[model samples]
Target: MTPTIRGFEHHRVPVDGDVSLHVAVGGSGSPIVLLHGFPQTHLMWRHVAADLAAGHTVICPDLRGYGASDKPAEAGPGTYSKRTMAADVVALARALGHERFALAGHDRGALVALRAALDHPAAVGHLACLDVLPTLDMWDVMHGVDAAVGFHLYLMAQPPGLPERMIAASADAFFGHFLDRWAADPAAIPADVRSAYLRACAAAVPSIVADYRASAGIDVEHDRADRTAGNRLRMPVTVVQQDWGAALGFDAASIWRAWAPDLRHTLTGHGHFMAEEAPAMIAEELRALLTR
Candidate 1:
């Protein structure tokens, strides 16, 4: 049986003309949307969403091109760009009767949240990003031998055909590599959740690669433009990370501060999949962000 948040009800909410998102919504009061990261689905937020839902309406969605959501072809650079994904988030909220909401995201979703907060500041009351650097700073910090840790980013950034075919040939291995590597406690995922992640990722190889490809191309351009225009996240923002800057030899908080002036930067020892590894703590941080 597929695992789902206990009290949450699921729906396919239409954001674009034919693009609907697979969302699980529960609780009441002010709304809060949680976006999942790469190689995973909204299921990643099962624990945290349920906790936050106790005090706030929680909306957990399989990001377009991930999990059970619609995966449109990579029409162009705009197709899977974070900018487009961010717009989908805004539309989803408004469609569900939330003009503005607190937002939180992990990994790739963090990139989308960052874009959403920047592009639709009026629609996001507060923001929280987990375990990712801004696209522009990510490229800037990663160089030389240390950059090898992010081998998948470079692999997926290639032209459409090659990366897709390469990843598709050994889908499980490619997708499971991160699931196995990034967790501090492998049991945090258990057997069922791990299987779900591998299955979902195997089925969405092309769209997933297209998402990363856009980050390397058009996403960078968007972030660059924002930096040039001196645009910063206008709302209260909280960033929870693993201190990647120490490993990559850069100041992570300083980079985030440049993008989010009203920022609360924090460090976590719970590993990459922190939401799964430390749900209570992740929920606590998000709850605090909502109060800010």
Candidate 2:
């Protein structure tokens, strides 16, 4: 069986008429939604959510097309676009009785949270993004050699059928490669938790590919439009990232500052899966973000 946040209660909240999100809610007071990254479930936030729930209501939901959440077939670019996923998040919070809440996300989830802050500024009181750049800036900064690090992004960006087939053929090996490679300490993710992440990812291959494909297409367009309109995040924002700038040859802080004027960018020594590797530090960063 998969492990969950110790004190949280799970619910299937309807974010759309045909789509419902598998969400975990715990604690009391003001609400804060925690979104999980790629190849993982809401379980990634297990440690951080539990810590935050002591004082604030923590909502951890597996995003659309990941984990136990509803994975609708991709009918168009909008099907898995960050804009749509952001809407689902807003609906989830509203259904749970929060008209507005603080928000935080890691990796792919960070992209979604960024969109939510942009499109629904009034609904997100504060924002925290971990280990990712805005979609437009991401594509801009990735150059020849450094772009190889994001090979999967290019692979999944292909027209639907091929990327889905290649990944699904060796699902465990494909998904497990990330779980193994991205963590600074392999043991940071316990065996059970790791297995749960792989299982959730393998079972949702097509939808996951669709999610990434949308990033390459519709997501970029949205970000471009936002930039053209000078639409910046109005709320205070926090960004926690590894010092990837040193190796990737780009200034991470300057990139994020373009969209977020009230930003606090912290560089961490942890790997991509920092939440699992350094939960205490991540939780503290989030607590500090909430106060801003």
Clashing pairs in 2: none
Candidate 2 whole-model C-alpha lDDT, 0 to 1: 0.94
lDDT of 1 by residue, 1-292 (tens): 7888899999999999899999999999899999999889999999998898888999999999999999999999999999999999999999999999999999999999999999999999999999999999999999989889899999999988999999999999999989988989999998888898898999899899999999999999999999999999999999999978777899999999998889999998888999999999999999888778
Q: What TM-score number comes out for model 1?
A: 0.99
TM-score of each: 0.99, 0.99
Model 2, position 27: C-alpha lDDT score: 94
TM value for model 2: 0.99
Q: In model 2, which range of ten residues has the least summed lDDT?
A: 140-149
Mark the regions of model 1 whose C-alpha exceeds 4 Å error after superposition: none
